[model samples]
Target chain A: MYKIFLTFILSILLLPYSSTFAVEVDMLIPPSDFQAFDTPNDDGKSVTLRWPSSPSESTEAEYVVYASLRKNGPFTTEVLRINSKTMYEEGSDSNFHYVEIKPGKFFNKDSDVTGGRSSYFFRLVMMSNSENVTVNEIASATPKGNWFNWKKLNNFIILIAFSTLVLWFIEHAKKNPNLYLRKISGLDAIDDALGRATEMGKPVLYVHGLNGMGSISTIAAVNILGRIAIRVAEYDTTLKVSNIDPIVLSVSQEVVKESYLEAGRPDAYVEDNVFMAASEQFPYVAAVSGIMIREKTAANFFMGYFYAESLILAETGASTGAIQIAATDSYTQLPFFITTCDYTLIGEELYAASAYLSREPLLLGSLRAQDIAKGIIITALVVGAALATIGIGFISFIFKAS
Target chain B: MNFFKRTIPLIIAFIMGIMMAFQYYVPHEASQSLLKVVTRWGITIAGFAVFIGAYSLFHLHWNKIKRKVPGWGYSTFVFFGAGITIIFGLYNGGEFFLHDKQEGTMFDWMYFNVQVPAGATMFSILAFFMASAAYRTFRARTSEATILLIAAVIVMLGRVPVGALIWEFLPPIADWIMSVPNMAAKRGILIGVSIGAIATSLRIIFGIERAYLGGGD
Candidate 1:
């Protein structure tokens, strides 16, 4: 026992050293001080880029170099993506992938991004090992200057205006809010669907999507389910909600129980009604779809984020001619839904449906704020454009003269 | 009405959201350091939520087994699968299959034999179902139907090798339809979608959307 304990202590002490691994990558050619001038190519909208590779590189499968206009680029912005090259094939190695920054691929878009005001920076990344792991940071011959667009005045003005509008609307909606969002047809039909299920003595089927938590659509579906559960409880109608995620299943159970208690029909609430169907996607789909067929559900509500399985569930419900109110944020599945379901909440409309159903003041207020923000953006664009066109001289002169 | 139930979680969520949003732009060390702490705490909380979820499942299944419900047999299967999976996973360095017993590994067997086949089957069924659905639904009874039918035919043919074999024009025509008309419609829908998302997010941020807080109307 003492020997074992000593060995454990010694191993624990040596763990950090055993695990310590460092990777260093460097470029050999043109050195760190190489310079390349921005020469106006005959192909007006083009600029050439060349970089050196690391000398003492290990057995790397390939090298990929990335370039951005800024040193620390705002990659989220569309401006930086105009001609972003992800794959830069290495020279001399036919098997190695490389980027040849030539015409048609990354230049000459007839935009205002020419005339030598653009600055570009490049980075070299090494990928080696069987797992295709990326190792060490490598730099290119510093950032270089490139051309710019003179006609970018309009685009700049529009961006400024839109930003202002969104900000203004956000602030305005926070105070003095008078927003009216339209009702969702699918949500409006819920009461009738639930009532029909009650009359027919059949369970109201609810599938709270097959997506994980960070999804806005899943949250919206859960919100709708809460309202539906309250109605079902009040009418003493049997409600079955099948979930793919265990977390979601637990939440659905709580939501159902709370709704029943709120409706003063706690005795009618059944724990088995809300269940975790399965973790695997198709299995969950088969189980839920099978349950719908077996139980002979009168009303089927498919709400939330869904994938290809959306069609299977929706079509199965359609075959039964059940009052199907299917809503999904997955754009690909929308075509299937629009053709099959009685009422379908298209894309963003599905996001707003829960708010409409639950007329909770916050949702209504937020909708109003968003509209206001959009209006503010439009106005800012108009004003910025007018200022930019009338004269950069006038705008700059005003600041300078002051 | 309690502070813990109502105000605290919302306040935390709002603060976290704003902090995360600002962290994208702010480069200060203090902000970055705080962001890391918040992120770690958030991850820990998420881990706890996972445990809670597993516990709920365990509790429910345990009750079913104890009561000897109608689906008690299925409960036994579930219990065995979960128990075996966990045991194998632990033995395989906290993975889902045994390391030493590669062929008989539970995860490899289930994933290959069950998950992959089921997923592939579901995907393959789509092709047959799409054909049947199109045949039944793509009648040119109305102007909309005619348009849809034409678009569907062009899309179906243009995607395959035979369309190029039949007519070179088919490819260009399909490309034009997809790029110009389809793109325009998709863009319009996208703009509307973004607007709705922004509106909804704004509502949530501004405390206008309480439906998520269990404030069911």
Candidate 2:
């Protein structure tokens, strides 16, 4: 009886120890429908993975994502905790879990692995209660370098449509160059300013703002300068062009010389008159200001991209009692120009001045196309505002740029 | 001569223009690498173009001095400044280009003392100019001018501490004007400018606008 009682007690103690070693439940249910694909619109540097959340996942469960260059083994792993309500809500709809893995970061390499050449494999494992379950299949994807990004498809479409419209108008204008463009007050004042300078027998000073040839504003300024140079040649008045960029200085010299030649006054074109004062900002402004004061210029034309120097140059011209005409696309400097200069071209007016002065079919067509585009944009803005007021938000997404 | 001067340049411009425009849409590494190379080449070309500007400056000043122009003395000062700066920069205080300028070097001393002070002095002069410009322009002669003057006053007052002491709502009203009307005008200008720039670029690429090529065909 004593031996029997002892054996029974020993067996009860061993029962609890055996339960600890034994598997509690079948926790090897793999995630379903695993997939990997190249992340779009990238430089072949990343791949995204997706899988249906395992039904076995609970509050205590953790996910471990693995990535490998080869299809099997030697995988680099990253632990992910999806314990919060936000995580569950994010992937709740399709019971989907997604992650983007950069192969370079995965392999701890300095160079990128997904250069559109290498294939990568990924797997997801779910761990709960010390038991783990991994996906049955190793998902693989080869990131490809796309020839074109589809995400910017909307941008491309808009660009193509506008470009085609402009080109069509250009062709039409080439046949008929009598397109109606509204009168811009700032541009109309150009003649008056030039005439004043001619009457005063003082040179007209044109300061090309501090920008290089790459800026459209600078190109517009130069184009306007050509028109002004022709008029100056006809009036037999001197024109001094002060430039801050070397390339623009060279180009302006050529343009002014050509204008003089076209006006049958090639002898009047002085190369020294169109010159670069300085490359640096304040120094250039100082040099130009000094010229404005010393020459006692009767009229000053400030055109192109102006920065902090706008007010300084304009104020000096104002002090000189010159007729100042300023034009720039820079909004910050617009207030300064308006307050100091006599006539100011507000934004697109600067661009329109070129077409207005040149009256070329190509430029006229471009200006007309821009007006149409602006009208469309304004209509869209009004429509978008109305839609939003009515609690329809989808129109905003349609008009979103990039 | 015509082919080399006109036709070849036009062809090159067309090819380059199209390539640059389309390259933005491509997400390929090779295309991006090519863009980098082209950008570097452009910078290199710009570096060489600086010499053209320097020569133009020298020629202008030399002519002025030769003719004994009214400001010929100023031209002499310009030469002196430029010569000294260039000499010191190239000398590098007996060090090579790869090494940094020594602490007591003439280049370092002149850059800190002469160039910096002159630049700062020029910048500081803008404050007085701005005040004078404001005084001349803030006169309320017309209705639009009156409104602009009021807005300017409110903005100036609201930015300082004295504004809050006078009127509590001044700051918020000023903020509203800047955020609403000012912002609206700014956005309108931005959109208009972007479209205009695009149109200009298209005209250039199509070779329909030859003003950049010296106006007349």
Per-candidate DockQ versus the true complex? 0.18, 0.67
Off by over 4 Å in 1: A1-180, A360-362, A371-402, B27-76, B90-107
The window of 10 residues in a row where model 1 chain B has the poorest summed lDDT is: B93-102
Query: Lowest-scoring 10 consecutive residues by lDDT in candidate 2 chain B?
Result: B208-217
Every candidate's TM-score, chain A alone: 0.55, 0.78
Worst ten in a row by lDDT for model 2 chain A: A80-89
Off by over 4 Å in 2: A1-36, A49-67, A76-116, A122-139, B98-105
List model 2 lDDT by residue over B89-109, tens digit each.
878888855688666789889
lDDT of 2 at B172: 92
Give TM-scores for every candidate, taking all chains together and pairing residue i with residue i: 0.66, 0.85
Give the Cα-based TM-score of candidate 2 against the true structure: 0.85
| Model 1 complex DockQ against the native | 0.18
